[model samples]
Target: MTERISDFAAIAGRYALRQPLRIELEETGMNNTTRMIYAGEERYVLRVYDNHRDREIAGTEHAILSELQRADLSFRVPAPVSNRDGATITEAPDGKLAAVFGYIAGQRPSPESGAHVEGLGRAAGELTLALAALNPDARLAPAYKPYYDFENTHAAMNEASVKTLCESSPKLAEQAAKAASLLETRRRLTALTERFKELPQQWIHGDIVFANALADGDAIAGLLDFEFCAVDARAMEPAVVLAEFPGEDDALAMNRMRRFCRGYGSKAGLGADEIRLLPDLMQLRLMDVWLHFAGRLAEGLDPERVWLRETERVSFACGWIDRHRRQLDVLFAAMAERQAAI
Candidate 1:
């Protein structure tokens, strides 16, 4: 087993003049391994990316944070700490990619808390509004698309890796086909990007799962992790918010969904069409999740640590499709309402 903290400290010591007095790893995030490092009076976050690609990804994250901060957005993001050479990237003892962030203090809201639900919604809404305020023409690399890419998701599931899952479990195949068909319609609609009225697109945090957020009381204390940030549809953020919740019942999931939309509307303001597209977008997001984990498994990566309840993920996906089928119709209805309202 890899000792995460000691690994982090060893990485930190190489970059900073003083080694951390203590390094505590936060184990909740799905992708990156995070550690809270206490060095002198300041607290910093040490993160190791799951993929060891080039340092350009890190640079993109750094740029996104700077832009968000510069734009004076409504939340907190990691601010990279510069070393003596005024550079954020530092070679660790283990020679893996590493960077540190200023730590902001806050607690994640319990899943059962109504306040937590509202906070999650509001934070997402505010982020969407803030992001929309930026220049849509802003340039960003394409690596950020996989998480929110509706088209790529359609391709992934029908492709070889995930198709094997469908073949292994006939029920899974049936459920996947139904889900994929709905997503296909959404994909076709989204492709006419020029035809649909374009909302202002700017830098968006590609991944906003539960762990990326922090809350104190009913308000978001901080919004951390921008490693997957890129320029994309304004709709992607709220779509992700809907995808994160794994409630046992559609009622509870809808409750959370409603709260999230209301909160986002508080800041960003959602139209009827946006609300309608959300359900399709939500399904699109789930398809992405399936492909994401499937891609990992196909690549021979162990998913024991990735899914919170590993064995149940497939069942949950199937259940979600079954329960939300009615809601899918509702989404289309909402879209029509949006067109009329507009």
Candidate 2:
């Protein structure tokens, strides 16, 4: 990592940018190495893709942003800066794909701030609406595995390899047990998957956690990171957002969830059926997270301690969602009714 930062001079020239006075590593996000580049009086974000194959994902992201730039949305998004050859991505000496983007100015929201939570909800809603306007294209199709798919969850839960991986941690073991019991019920899972298949499909920002949102005071100034962008179920977008937003308590979390749904309702109204299916979709999102970590553990990439923390968090969230399922149904129903009236 030290060597990569020191070699920024050669890399920066590829994008027609001057040598950086300083290159500070932005040590956030698990997937990529990002750096803040200071070149003379200008600033930009330099992202080094984790794998060479990520170039396709980068190309798709660039296209999505290009389309979004035309929309009159409220929040700003990262715009890809092209190299001298008009290519958005360039290869480094190590065969990794990298790109520079026009810097988006703002900071991530404070975890304890209710106003920031609401702003994030509204920003996600606005982005969803804007993305809806841009017609779906083949480039937006997911290049990686579909983590949110129920069939994927079903397979992962049943795998002996995954079971062996879970045995290493008590939390994962318990989650595995719970998954088995839930699958035994079977009817709900089957119905939920069927309903999910019926929901509208479109290109969505696959990851919309707080870290990807930039806030200025109480408002969302920009939405960053579109590398996970893909064509998927529309409900999955709000489901992911609601799962990620921070809330101090169940009451606060419920309120935040309602606000998010309302914000999304304002632009693209949820169907009554879609409203009814939101809880299941939310549960599915949590399960998706669980499976992702389990996969990481199985691959020997995640530490048992870290995997335990993630598994426990997902397990607790699933239970909480189950307890408040009825309340969420009522809130989403009201939102759908209001949208119908509008």
The number of the candidate with the highest TM-score is 2
Query: What lDDT is obtained when candidate 1 is compared to the true structure?
Result: 0.62
For all predicted structures, in order, the TM-scores are 0.77, 0.90
Which tens-of-lDDT digit does each residue in 12-50 have in candidate 1?
775654543677756536666677777778778887776
RMSD of 1: 4.8
lDDT of 2 by residue, 1-342 (tens): 666765565567787776545677765467877888887788898887874457677888888898888888888998888999999888876778888888888888864677777677677777888887666557665554443464554565455655577676676676676555444433355556756777887778878878888888888899988887776778777788777643348777877777766667776766767778777777677767766676777777878776677766765676677778788778878888878987
TM-score of 2: 0.90
Q: Could you tally the backbone clashes for each prediction?
A: 2, 0
As a whole number from 0 to 100, the lDDT of residue 50 in candidate 1 is 62
Q: What is the lDDT, from 0 to 100, of the residue 70 in candidate 2?
A: 88
In order, what lDDT does every prediction score?
A: 0.62, 0.73
